[model samples]
Target: MDKAEILVIGSGPAGLKAALSAAEQGAEVTLVERDPFLGGQLVKQTHMFFGSKEQYAAERGFKIAEKLSREVEAHPGIRVLCDTTALGYYDDGVVSLEVKGRFATVKPQSLIMATGAQENTLMFPNCDLPGVYGAGAVQTLMNVHGIIPGKRVAMVGAGNIGVIVSYQLLQAGVEVPAIVEALPHIGAYHVHASKVRRMGVPIYTSHTVLSAHGKDSLEKITMVAIDQDRQPVAGTEQELDVDVLCIAVGLTPLTEILFQAGCKMVYIPELGGHVAMRSDTLETSVPNIFVCGDVGGIEEASAAMVEGSIAGLTAARNFGYGKDSYEDQLAAARRELDSLRSGPVGEKIRSGLKRLSSFGEVTQ
Candidate 1:
């Protein structure tokens, strides 16, 4: 059986950092990505990130991705597999994959799952309309493909993705009529809210989109004020003549592989959806199998990268690489992640993860 010390999936911030760190610390690593190009979600993120200097603070997402991608490519200890999809994981870290149009299997001593996340959808009339796109899909079209989704857009949900995508639409000269949120207050950071507000996109709190109108495509949308129970109030419906309805309600972790391979899973609405339970080093219940980034929980990219580093470092340490420095690096990464998941906004994530790991001393 062909084998390597480490195999990483997704090549997002988490996978990139994990693979690179694993290689730097002493393992022969293979980093695989399904996309033709590298960088995962970072490739389509045009805005600067918010974090400390070590986390690529103030740098744009695309730039940080590019930098890490270069490092991954130049590292002789690592192999890059673009246009690759890991189809299955088995006992002993055996993975079946489609690589460059050919089916293959990889046997690695350790495996890291950094598959990231996908956009969530909301149920509504005509939700399957042609012009209704997921927030990530809309962001990809405008930011990556350089094509605006539509002339006028209505952003559903005022979470970070919704607000950021709305701001990006403005930069692309697209019209954003409003950002609708079912909650009493905007869910995204104040910085994001203020920027979009200053640009004239009204934030409608306690509002919910009830339907998207038109046959075969989106022509307009209907929304209403929601009551305290989150139910639509009577006689509060409003219709907007928007071309596209972008749904950015939330995201869900891409942890199917982990689930298939028999890892413990937990559902945490705050963390997006079902996530794999892992240790501080990011190792899942399965021995030598690790998870980080959105696959573990739907945190931001900065947190994902830090988690990736921890997973890689810990994996390397287990394999007898950088034995002295591994623990120190892992501790630092954990500290950084803890700091990021603090404060008022991070309370939900912190609590969710705590619940996931509450059952101590697990083995598989």
Candidate 2:
């Protein structure tokens, strides 16, 4: 059986930071990534991040991923295991894994789940057509693999992902006919929204994709405006000729591992979808089973990094490591998290956290 002081499942922003922080605190850390490479979705993010300098603001996401992955690889205390899928968390505290098609098991004193999230898809007629794609899949194809998705694309959702991916598509010389959003207003940051608008992309609020049309692949799509009651308005249907329909509605926290571990779960829409109930330190109800990143809740990558740092520090402290300055580091991380979650953009996250804090009352 493989043994570790702290096992971090993921190699994204959160997992990378968690492994680094724990290793820096003199803990033997094992970092496992399912993909053959590190950096999770960060590798496909071509745009610059928005946050304070501490969060590496103004740096392109892929660059940040490179730096973090380099640190993780060079760290002597960390054992990097790429192409390893964490199968399940057993009742006896042994986590099973499949490393390159071979089964293995690791018994770690503490486990940090940074499994991230999955994109949410919209339901409509012919939505399962060939030309339909998720925002992440589009990003990977274009940014990572250097393949254009289509000549003309229509995007669903006006949130950050939709808006940003639309901008990226435009940069790649793809024609974005329009961006359809069911919400009454665009959910992206004003700067991003303005950029897309400046580029001649019209954002349709209170609109949704009604159906995709094509026999083999998407050739056209019908969109319609909706009322405040979320019902489609008659006579508002508009059809656009497009080859690709990208869905970027949102994401749901990937909490299957936490569920298998018997962690308390809660449904918090503001945090994306259902998430495991966690404490300020990012520790779940299951002792020594910490969670961070999108696995705990949906938020920006910057916030995920800070949460990873907190979870790592607290997990290492559980093993009596980092005793000298654990409190200071944890406090600093929390303050940074609060600052990141401040302002109008963070209102939804704030409300979700408020609801999560009162989980007992909510459940009762």
Candidate 3:
């Protein structure tokens, strides 16, 4: 068993930020990552982030991860456990994990679950083929492992993940046939959409895959434009010869532990499914444990980092490990959170925040 003043699970942008913040506040922090390396999805992100300079926007995500890792390495108060998957959590802030092929348990005074989000899969005829993969998996293969998943690919979903991965595939010398979206317009940023468009990858709006055909592997795909009701229109079927089908429709929060631990949940499709109702401090229904990052909801890395900091600082304060000015530190964290959620896309997040805020009264 291992113990720390603060235990942060996941080691992505959220977990790293959480651990670093807590350490800076003089709390002993242990950061656990499921992967053999730290940086979670940040390592997969090869593109520059958007937002303000304070958030390291315009910098490539891989570079940002390197910088963050360096910070964590410099901090003596922070212990990073790589290749450790936190299997589950208990009500007493105790966690069970598999660490480098060994079983381990941790009981921390404060817990921050930054387990991040998982890909939301869409089902269609023959969608379960071997050549099909989540957009994130494609990234992991190309960016991390230096291996291309396939030569020609048809990406299903024109959202940010789909768009970004398509561009990255092009970078790695893979051909992207088309990005199919069931909506009339691309669901990602205009800049990302334009980048793929300029590269000659067609964006098929109001379209959905009818079937992905292949015996042992994916050999081709048939797609068609659909009406507002998502029913395929007649005579719009087109077959694209591609070996891979990448699904990037969206992400869902990895909230199984939160649910298992008996945290109150509210399902908001906009927020990407059942998330713990949290206070301004990022405290969940369970008072001593906090939830942050994509596990809270699917948002940008910028928002995830801010939320992680909020959870870490709040955790430190809860454990009586912070300075006399801990309240002021928390106030600063709140300001950071507010700034990240104040953009055009933030209107939807405001609704999520409102939903999460309601959890407090239910407990009282």
Candidate 4:
């Protein structure tokens, strides 16, 4: 079994920051990523992020990923295992792994779960068609692999991912016929929505995809206006002759490992889905096991990074690392997180966190 002072899973913005924070505190850190490379979803994002300077504001998402991944690769106190999947956590506190198909184990004094999230799918007739894809998949095809998804695309959900992906599709020389959202208003930032609108992509609020039509693959999709109760209105059906249908409804926290570890879980829709109950310091109910990023609750990459820093700092402090500046560093992380979630845009997340807190403390 390999040993580590701190073990961080998922190598996304959160895990990268976690490993760096702990390593800088003199901890022996091991970062694990299931993908052949690090950076998680950030690697597939081509849009510039919006946040304070500490969160790499104004920098393109992929550029931020490149910077963080480079730092992680060069960190002396951190060991990185890409193409490795953490299989499970056992009662004995050992984490089983499949590293490039071979079994391995890691016994860590502290385990930080930064597993991030998975895209949520929309349901409709023929939604399983070949050309249908999640927003993340579309992003991977266009941004990462340089492959355009389709000639004309009709997007479902006017949320950030959907709107941003639409813009990216336009950037890739693909036409976006329409963006449909069941909600009465667009869920993305006004700037993103405005940009897509200026690009001639129409956004239909109070609309939903009724069904998709194709014999072998996706050829077109039927959408309709929805009422406040979310029921389709009569005679509002419309068809878009687009080859691709992109679903960007939302995401859910990836908490399988947390479940296996027997951590307390709570359901928070605004946070995406069921998440592990964690302390303010980001430690889960299961003692030294900590959770940051989407596994705790879905939030932006900036907040996830800050939470990772908090988790790593707290975990390292548990082992006498960074005793001198631990308090200062932790306070700074907390302040950053608070600032990120302070504005009106953070209301939903704030409400979800409030619900989670109502469950009271999860005893170790």
Instruction: Choose the strongest candidate by lDDT.
Output: 2
TM-score of each: 0.97, 0.98, 0.95, 0.99
lDDT of 2 by residue, 1-364 (tens): 9898899999999999999999999999999999999998999999999987899999999999999999999999999999999999989999999999999999999999999999998889999999999999999999999999999999998999999999999999999989999999999998999999999999999999999999999999999999999999999999999999999999998888888999889899888888888777888888899989988878999999999899889999999998999999988898889999999988998999998998852120
CA lDDT scores, all candidates in order: 0.89, 0.93, 0.87, 0.92
Instruction: Evaluate residue 331 in candidate 4 and report its C-alpha lDDT on the 0 to 100 scale.
Output: 88
Best first by lDDT, ranked: 2, 4, 1, 3
Off by over 4 Å in 2: 360-364
Clashing residue pairs in candidate 2 are none
Error of 2 at 52 (Å): 0.9
lDDT: worst 10-residue window of model 2? 355-364
Q: Write the per-residue lDDT of candidate 1 for residues 87-114, one digit (tens) a residue.
A: 9987666789999999999898888999
Counted clashes in each candidate structure:
0, 0, 0, 0
After superposing candidate 1, which stretches have Cα over 4 Å from the reference?
A: none
Model 1 scores worst on lDDT over the 10 consecutive residues at 355-364
TM-score for candidate 2, residues paired by index: 0.98
Better of 3 and 4 by lDDT: 4
Across 1-28, the per-residue lDDT of candidate 4 in tens digits comes to 9888899999999999999999999998
